[model samples]
Target: MTVQDIRSFNRFYTHLIGALDHGRHLYAPYTLTESRVLYELAHAPRTDVADLRTQLHLDAGYLTRILDKFERDGLVERGPSERDPRRRRIRLTPRGRETAELLDERARQAVGTLLAGVAPEDRPRLAEALRTVRALLSGGRVPRPEDVVLRAPAPGDLGWIVQRNAALYAAEYGWNAEYEALVARIVADYAQDHDPRRERVWIAELDGRPVGCVMCVRDTAPGAARLRLLLVEPDARGLGIGDRLVAAVVAFAREAGCREVVLWTNDVLAAARRIYRRHGFTPVAEKPHRSFGKDLVGQDWRLDLRAASE
Candidate 1:
């Protein structure tokens, strides 16, 4: 077998054996589906069937069957919601809670034993890598929230941002190397002459991982600033990270005594345009530019910072 094939087979075998061992001890009289239901209820006692349907991505018929089994087995109780009689909520019974706790402990012990020999120093890194693998396998998505801190970019973060932006644009709109290189140049120049008082770069980090970035620079015009290189990772696009970053840069520009903030972007970035408009930016100009061997339309958007605050 090829080296990659052997490695894949070993990984699968290891997981399969570990799962079987866990099941042997944890599977009481309950089926796997039943146990899953009980576990969900134990964690979220007032959960509705619709929430469970979405979380587990199960069809109505299958979920109903499982709920019926759980009810008959005395593992869960379902009733009409107090606020909405049309909705039904599920809760684990006392006996079900006990069973779930036992199963949880057993599964944890089994996995802990499997990793017992791994050094403590490496466990966190290993767990993070596994989580990333799981996320990629599931759908290559990440969650974004305001509690996510946007800070100065770390080592390798700018490179990752550049690569992701190039790949995503290429896949979605046929952008190429010239576009990537332009982004790289903007980032490199900012890095080379970073000014804490007048120019700043920020990266949005959620759960200690970089998810988005933006840069504010001194403008050529007196009392003006420019926002450049604003990007959010594909998985994190919908979570308002872009809006947060834009707001931050605008606030920073105001603090730096700037009367206006300007930005340049492609028409393809409709969402970003929407954000800029919502923050009171007006489209001041548009021009056709050839880059990455593609004719692209670029828009120059300007936000009057002084007018916004007043």
Candidate 2:
């Protein structure tokens, strides 16, 4: 799963970057690796052909060729190291710095353009995900489930909640447009009429994208809260997001002084059922029903938070 996920992301990222002028550094007549070399020279405290070759894992001969090109273009100056005359140190020329700056701006704008549609609220997730990718690729420490962030719905997150849930259910369960409409309606209602004290939504983010979500809303029964719309992305499953989301809802219910928390789900949703059971919810009722283009048994479960909290 890890390998497939990484490969999928690679394909997506490659396509995304390629759309930015085939992944070449825009506004610079340099290939990606060439630009990287310039970036290191511009930023690194000490840079030499040997260090660049080792750090970048480029062949020594190949790195020397790149340096030769940079020197010819007046983008770099090389001289014998002060500490070891046998070794050569490299530095960016003024023109090289100018080129690097241009490359930097182009890169920044390119990323900004890609994320322009992203809600300002979710930018932190994107940053975190980038760090995770770097760490994973570099064979560094990987974050645990507790490292996953649960945040409030940012702009566009509500829409995402509806879209992803609908899409996932449709693909996985053979449900149809009716389910999508239901999700859209639920989101619309929440958006229009949620009470701050009694209603809340949490979006579980992994690597800057919404992987799961849940809502705790005022139940029709007085002093009760309804746990609604719990979902976890397929890739993010087994990471405890569903468990975390349910836990968040239950905790909030207790904090808000709700006497009980309730939820309704189909029996076919085995994983979710297990999560709810672990959190002390007991099945209160079950009935056969036709919904979302399927004939299924719907179960209502409730958690007596007052009892559980004590």
Candidate 3:
């Protein structure tokens, strides 16, 4: 892309941001930069002033002025750093935390409304594209391992699992509604009849948004857990999220006293297959099939917790 192209995008994005952040940074009294400082502090409770300035890449003098204003308004407090007596530490007051929470809620709602205008099938593609832009423009900074979180599925997550699986497959692979139906059935079964001890679903979150997911449900056969619906967002791929999800399933399966873990997947999903192989899953069976609006070869993979099984 040319410089003019980049500039054009910047202009468009600036107006889009201005509209999204109406009422002075999502209806708060603070300016955009001040709201950003609060947001950083809200995520990282107490931080050194120098570190904060570096993280935001703001001019030292300007940041100091913002901090001064914040302190005068009683939103933040400055103190000698406990870690280093030579430096200053910044902490938000209780009121400041409340304001930060409000900002977060408002930002979520604003983004939700923006997304509501988009077709449901296109959100994943749009989300991935946005992340790609950030990653590229940020000098390809690698996200830390801690940035990806794996937690038990919360309300609405099961539905998300089905929807994302359906939308992503249909968009990327030209799969049909039958695929979505299958995902819906699988998720509904888990939702209606799942034992906490023997079955679990994990949602992978990045930047507080769901980006990937997997599940381990009790297979019809005894002594085996079935791994299902392993997926990582396209832009989130290099962060090893897919591997992490599979690893979680293995850990849970072993802890649940399952002799082995198994999964069914198509040959086209090479990335997921690689992760499974890395975790010692071997293809146990394969067959040609006509399904999901495609001619495909489906494979059954097994990971034996028993030493010999591996």
Every candidate's lDDT: 0.76, 0.82, 0.84
Model 2 residue runs over 4 Å out of place are: 1-143
Off by over 4 Å in 3: 1-142, 308-310
Residue pairs in collision within model 1: none
Please report the candidate that would top lDDT against the real structure. 3
Q: What does candidate 1's lDDT look like per residue over 1-310, in tens digits?
A: 5779869978996886666585465656766676666666654445678877776667889999988987887777888864488988876775665677688676666666767877989988987987675566557445525335555565578787788778877887898888899888877887788676678777787655777888898888888899987878776777778887887788677767889999899888888899998888999999998877778899999998777877
| Global local distance difference test of model 2 | 0.82
Model 2: colliding residue pairs: 125-208, 126-208
> In candidate 2, how many Å is residue 201 off?
0.6
Model 3, range 1-310, lDDT digits (tens) per residue?
A: 9999999999997898678766555856877788888877755555789988987889999999999998898888999986799999997776776777687678777877788889999988997898888778868667764466666676689999999999999988999999999999999999999997789888888765799999999998899999999988887888878887887788667767899999999999888899999988999999999999999999999988987334
For candidate 2, lDDT tens digit of each residue in 185-290? Answer: 9899999999967898988876666888999889999999999999998878877788878877876677678999999999899999999999899999999999
- Candidate with better TM-score, 1 vs 2: 2
Estimate TM-scores for all models: 0.55, 0.58, 0.56
